[model samples]
Target chain A: MSPLLEVNELQIAFGGVKAVNGLTFSADAGEIVSVIGPNGAGKTSAFNCITGFYKPVSGSITLDGKDITGKRPAVIAATGVTRTFQNLRLFPDLTVLDNVRGGMHLYGGQNFVDALFHTPRYRKSERFYTEEAHRWLDFVGYQGGRGIPVRNLAYGQQRQVEMARAMARKAKLVLLDEPGAGLNHSEKQDLLELCRKIRDLGAAVVLIEHDMGVVMEVSERVVVMNFGKEIADGTPDAVKKNPAVIEAYLGKADEPVKADEPAKAEGPDITEGDS
Target chain B: MSDNVDTTRAPRRIGKPASRISRLFESRQLGWAAFAIAVLFPFVLASNYAMSIGTTAVIFILLASGLNIVVGYCGLLDLGYIAFMAVGAYTSGIIAKAWELPILFTIPAVVIMCILAGLIIGGPTLRLRSDYLAIVTLGFGEIIRLTANNLAITGGPSGIYGIPGVDLFGLDLSGPVPFYYFCVAVVALMVLGSARLGKSRLGRAWRFVREDEDAAEAMGIHTYKVKLAAYIFGAIWGGIGGVLFAAHLSAISPQSFVFLQSALVLMAVVLGGMGNTRGVVVGAVVISLLPEFLRDMGNLRYVIFGVVLVAVMVLRPQGFWPSRAYEPEKLDEARKGKRDGGPRPGAPVTTAKGGTP
Candidate 1:
């Protein structure tokens, strides 16, 4: 079967700058792939292009062998691609449960007429929506009050809500942008396990993360980028040892150390590159 | 690590007395109370002037509810909502006069015209956000009124007259008392429908769009289509109100559907509380009746009205009855598990803060 998502020769530019240039990647069902790179590496930009938030200058994005390039975000989302933003984008005024129900918008069994009249179908569908929202919130281990506005939750709790919202889509492919940012070590570990669980549920999971620990622990395959170009692609062990990956993470030096030696230094170096 | 987290979630609170008043207003009892008052008002007053004012207030309530769909629920700023009302009134008025039919019989045609009007105005303008949308809708409102003023079928500036009263099941509802009750029933049903729509899936989508369009789109809501749906619903409600407006007056005129009328309807939505149906109804009643009650003030009634509105805004920017945001509580075993010493079955271990396994 064709991969769940495939992008080929994707190029997008903003005025004079090429945010993503001829980047290519593919993810399959039941796989967890991480895209890790230095800041301005165009990871988020590429994710935006695939999700239809940003129109690419030239390329093809196909989902299950169907071209979906440049489609509206809602249209692309309807085809089973769901994502979380780098910043927590939970509706601040909406309750946590409502925020998650938002992901289930396309899974419709009722329309405006049913809503106006409060038909049995409307009640049934709404009940299902609420139940599923609670289920996903539970799955993500959100301990905050589901009835309160998400703005009331701590930043880390809000991140969990955003993940639950994305997962609530029940999509075939899920893209998480910096899912581990601002998370404590324990939360990051939980996120790792959640990624695996998502893959086990027969969905493709792609994440852009700065936390090397998460990228290395959770990703079955890793793709590294720098300046909008894919510089390395392999298993975590292989990518860690790639000379170019090391050079990109830690600026060029007189002597190239072994992969294990620079592992501790990689985190700070990546943080330095972010600014 | 969670000690300073402020995890003791407190129930959201407004001011003490305000919260109590809001709770009272939010209850189903308020709807019943309003309905009862509407039913009993004519009996107590009985005068033609009082009945007329009451009937007009009922129609105003319908107008406010319709505008609520677009402005309050969907967060579309409509400056020319009166245009939809005009479309409905004119379509029904012309059909009733030309066909010699009761105004009630022209409802199907009125609905179609309102939908068309909604599409015509909402299609192009829904793309523009905020202030631009306000400008375009204001233009459409004026354009609709001007077209009616110049059209012979609409009787130009004089508009259509001698429009027959609404007849239901051979019962002539032309008398003031009977018509007032009829308006009450119909307006009650329409208000109920609008409130029901506010709780539906589409309503949630509207709120989502209102809150964050980009996030709403990312969640698979077609923001444009959702917005257009709000516009159409608003148009239909306004159109139906127009049918009642025509029936109430037995005549239609361009002078009635002016920009100030639209502003008054908007003021009702804002003053009552934008998304709360009960508040909108209350706002409509207050806006429509306050002037009648202040008639002794002569021309200064409007100035007082303006001052009162400004005072209300200054005191409660959220309106009289702000829409309540709620979440349905399910069986929360996790919270239970926290209190007890045992972990809930199937509960993820990661919920324990600092327990990095």
Candidate 2:
């Protein structure tokens, strides 16, 4: 079967800087992939390009074997790709259930006339939306006031709400941007299981994470990126042993190893001269 | 960890007393009470001037509710909303006079013209955000009024007069009391329609767009289309109000569609509470009737009205009847059902190990 999402030779630039350059990756259904890198390693930039937030200078993005590159975010979302921002972007003033219902926008079972008249169709659709919103909130193990505005919830709870909102989309592919950031220990645990649950739902899951522990524990495969390019792609064990991956996270060794030298041979040429 | 969650999750209700008061106002009983008062107003005050003012206040309620759709529900600041009203009034007035037909016969023309007006004003301006949008709409309002002022068909500066009263079926709704009741019924229906629209799926999309445009877009809502829908709905409401205004006055003029008219309608929406239907109605009534009520003071009345408005703004920036921001607890109960038990008491705290599988 075709991969759920495929990004090929993607490039995005701001002025003279290439934020994401020639990045390629594919995520299949029922798999958890973690994209790990240092700060400004362009992981988020690549995610943005994939999600249609940033138009890439050049590349092709296919979801479920259909080209979706450069589509508007809403259009891309309708094609069964949903994402969460690095920063929690919950509708702060809306109720927790409303925030999750945001994901169900494409589920249009009622129109303006139905709404204005309060027809049976409108009532049925509204009831379905509310029930689905609650189910997703519970799926994420959210233990907060469902009726209150999300702004009233604690930071960790807010994160869960965002996760629930993303899951509520029922998208074929889910991209979680730093879902573990700023989360406490127990919250992160809940998030880890939530990610697994997402994968188990038969949706392809790609997450950008900084926490190596969570990344190692949850991801089936790890794709390491540095300087806007992929440096390593393998199972968690193999990627961990890849010297280029080690050098990308920690600074280079005193003597560069021959095995991983090809991956970083042009690093000096690409690195701009800055102290 | 569980203990920490419990401590932070204290059941803190928001604005308990205020919500209770709002609930009372929001009840169907309040609607019935207001309807009864409207029904009995003619009996208490039989004077022509009193009846006329009451009719105007009802029309003004329609205008404010219309503006509430654009400003409150959709969060689009439209300053030229009066243009649609002008379109409706002029279309009906000209059609009724030139064709020698009853004013009620012009309803279809009024609706079509208002829709065209909505598109003309909203198509380009809705792309602009906040202040820019407001400025453009203000300009559009002036443009429409100026065009009406200059055009001969629209009666130039002298304006259109001798416009006939509405004839519904066989009954001539021309007299002060009959017309007052007619206006009351029409305005009440319009108000109910607007309120119902606010609770629909499309309405939720509007509020979502208001809260966060990008987030709403990411959720597959086309913000532009939703905003346009709001503008069109506002135009329809205003246009219908124009029909009532023309019928009540038996005349139409460019002066009636001035920036001040738009501002007053906006003021009603803001003073009452932007998103609250009941609040908007109350605000409209107060703004429309306060000057008439203070007519005994003559010149001092204007000064007092201005002072009162300013004081209200200072005291309650959220409006006299702000919309409540809470969801019902039905979803909470649904969630609890899935959890087997709700809010575990004295549940053991569990730590998440970094390397736990």
Candidate 3:
């Protein structure tokens, strides 16, 4: 099958600094691929470009063979890519159920008239939404006060609500940015198992994660990057031993061997080995 | 981590049935009762001036509630809200006078004008967020007023005159009692619709976009669309209120739709709890009637009004009545029926690495 998403020569600049430079990658269907990089390594820049939050200076983004470069964020979202942020972005003032129901907006079971008139169709759609919200909240293992404002919940619970909201979108590809950042050990473990479960449900999962243990343990494959350039693309073990990947993470030592530079994988095949 | 210590999550047991007086005070049924009293109030009183004041108060209530949707629920500070009100009043007035149609017949035209006005103001400014958006709306309000002052179709400063009231099948709705009742019905519908919308999905989206645009968008809610919808709905509300206003006064003037009116409408939204419908109702009534109630004070009335507003704002920044604390019995019975426990214990009590399991 063709890859679910493809990015080619994606380059974005901010004045003098290049946030994402000549980056190219693709993620296949049903894969749990992790993008690993050091701080300020253009991971989020790439995510923003793909999600249409930032325009790439040079690149093409294709989803299921359709070009969707520089589209509006909502339009891009309609193409079946959804994401969560590094910082939890739950609607704090609204009830937990409302926040999750927001994910199904594009489903359009009811229009403005149905909402205002409280028609039978409206009631049916509302019931469906509440039931679906309950199911997803349950799936995420979010055991918090569902009726109250989300801001009232603890940090980890807020994170779960965000996850539930993303799941509510019913998207084909879920981009989870730093899902394990502030989560406790057990919560991180829950997240790992959840990613695998997400993959089992037939959606491609693209995650940008910093925790080595969580990334190494959960990802089907991993891509390593440094200074906006892809350094390694392989299974976890293969990437763990790749010299360039090592140099990217730990600086290269003096007197390095003048051997052949492993040719950069041509086209978007570079994303094949990354889980 | 605190699953074992579940004292906070304990459910409460009900005692005896609530008293009728207390129940009336607590439920929205009280608002309907007040509306009924306002409607029938003119029949009990013989004075035309009293009925007129009541009619004006009702119109003000509609304006306040409309404003509450944008400023209160959506967290948009619209200093130009009166412009929508102006558009509605002018559109209806010009149509009613020119075509000799009853003011009620101009409603569709009013609605269209207000929606256009909302888009014109909201489209460019909503992207600014918070204080900046407020300043832009203020400018737009002035722009509308200046445009009205310069335009001839608005009949210069005097605006349109002798605008016809509701005329239906030989019955005269022109009498003060009939007019008062009509105004009451209109205000009631506006208030009820606003309150209902607040509890619906669109209202939730407004709240979501207001609190955090990025988060709402991340949830796949188009924040811009939600904000625009809020603007349009709010405009429709203000437009309808303007229709009632022109009918009540039987004339329109550019002076009537001023910045002060916008400020006053916003004040009512704030003085009442911003997002709470009942609070807005109370706020609108008090704000409109307080000046009349203080008529005996003469010049001192303005001073007392300022002091009272300051004190209220200082004491209750969230408004006189914030949303009531969650009362399980008062909530939708379906949601209340979902449990024996108040809420489930926090997700199987994940053990912290160092803390007790």
Candidate 4:
């Protein structure tokens, strides 16, 4: 069977800058793939393109073999693709339960009339949402007041709430952008274990993480990106030994490697004075 | 991590038993108490003038509650809300006068007209961002008023007159006291309905859209559709208020639906608390009745009314009673069935983790 999410040759630009140039990656069901990149390597831009926050200038994105390229964000989300923002986009003024229930909207199973009338069906749906929200929060190990506003929670608790909110979507593919950023060491450990649990749910998981320890330990495969293109794609051990990956993360060696140099040349020539 | 960057989380407890005073102030009880006071107002001052003022306040509450759905909940600032009132009043007035139907029977037609107007106005403008939407709605409000001002069927500047009040069981409800009761019952129902909507799934969607449009979309909420739903609901509420207005006065005029009227209704929503229906109710009564109550101060009462409003805003920028993020604990009910105090006693329960043991 094909991969669950297929993003091929995705390209996006902001004025003169090519944020995501010819990036290609795929994640299969029950697999956790980590996209590790330096600052401005276009991981978020690629996420935006795949999620339809930004339309790509080129390339196609497919989920379950159907093209979802250029679809609206809501349409893409409804198609079983859900994501968490890098900056923790929980509704600050809404209760923690409401934030998680936001993800459960698609499955809430009641329309406006049912809600307005408070029919038995609406009550049942609301109950389902409430139970499911608590379940996901439990799954994410969130420790905070469920009824209070998320803005009143600690940063770590807020992060877990965001995780619970994303998981409540029950999407086939989950994209987490820097989920471990600003998390405590214990929280990071919990997040790594949570990644495995998510993958075990038979969903494809792609995470953009700056934490190498979490990425290497949790991801089944690591796709290293630099200059908006994949520089290395392999098992964590193999990728850790890739010279180009090291050079991208750290500065380059005095001598240049010629074999992998061709792939970088194929990307958009936005690096003005690289030559 | 900064000293004062809104790190307002106070670690205490979830599902804290509310105090007696706070419990009494819960939204549901507050709504009932407000309506009860409204029902009892005529007993204190049984004058026709007071009754008329009371009736107008009820209608104004309907308008403010309706606008709350749009501006307060959905975060769409509409400056042309009064246009909906004009459409409702005109539709009801013309139908009741020409076809000679009872004014109460004209409700369905008024609702239909308001929906059409909502679509015509909200469809294109909602696609624009907040500022542009506000500007376009301002223009749309004018367009509707001007359309009424020009239409000969509406009697142009003078508007339709001799409109019959609601007649129920051969009772001419046009008398001040009877009409006041009618307006109260209708406004109460409308307000209750609006509050019910505010607690529903669509209502949550509106708050989500208001808080963050892009994030709301990422969570699978179609921002455009939800926004339109809010707009239409708002129009329906305003239109129904118009029907009440026309019936109350037994006449309709273009002058009644002016930009200032829209602003005052908006002020009520802003002053009371944008998303809270009970707050909107209080805001409406205060805005409409404050000037009347201050009539003893003569011409200076307007300035005092303006000063009081400004002072309230200055003191409470969130409005008189802003919407809070406090959600009631339905989770506890679910948890009681699943988890009980058998294993972990006095262990300082923190995380609301729920799953199979």
**Candidate 2 residue runs with Cα over 4 Å from true position:** A255-275, B1-10, B15-22, B331-357
Give the per-residue lDDT digits (tens) of candidate 2, residues B23-107.
6765778987988899999999968999999999999999999999999998999888888899988898999999988988898
lDDT of 3 by residue, B243-274 (tens): 88888788888898899999988988899889
Tens digits of per-residue lDDT, candidate 3, A79-187, equal 8888898888777766677777777677747776777678998777766677566556766777665666666778998888888888878888889999987889899
lDDT of candidate model 3 versus the reference: 0.78
Second chain TM-score for model 4: 0.89
State the weakest 10-residue window (summed lDDT) of model 4 chain B.
B1-10
Candidate 2 has which clashing residue pairs, if any? none
Interface RMSD of each: 7.0, 6.9, 9.0, 7.3
Please provide, for model 1 over B1-357, each residue's C-alpha lDDT reduced to its tens digit, 9 standing for 90 to 100: 223113423345322224576556557788899999999998799899999999999999999999999999999999999999999998998888887887888999998999899999999999999999999999999999999999888899988889888898799898999999999999999999999988888888998999889889988899999999999999999999999999999899999999999999999999999988999998999999999989999999989988999999999999988776654344333232334443322234345311111
Q: For residues A1-275, what per-residue lDDT tens digits would candidate 2 score against the true structure?
A: 87888899999999999999899889998899999877788999998888788999998999988999999888898888888889988888788878888888788598888877889998778877876676676667787777788877889889899888888888888999999889878778888898998887788899998777788888898898988989998887788788897787545676565544464443321121111
- DockQ for the candidate 1 complex? 0.34
Error of 4 at A245 (Å): 1.8
Sorted by lDDT (best first), the order is 1, 4, 2, 3
True contacts kept of each: 0.52, 0.53, 0.24, 0.56
Q: Which parts of model 1 are misplaced by more than 4 Å?
A: A254-275, B1-23, B331-357
What are the TM values for chain B, all candidates? 0.88, 0.89, 0.86, 0.89
By DockQ thresholds, what CAPRI class is model 1?
A: acceptable
Recovery fraction of native interface contacts for candidate 3:
0.24
- Provide the lDDT at A81 for model 1: 89
Q: Clash totals for all models, in order?
A: 0, 0, 4, 0
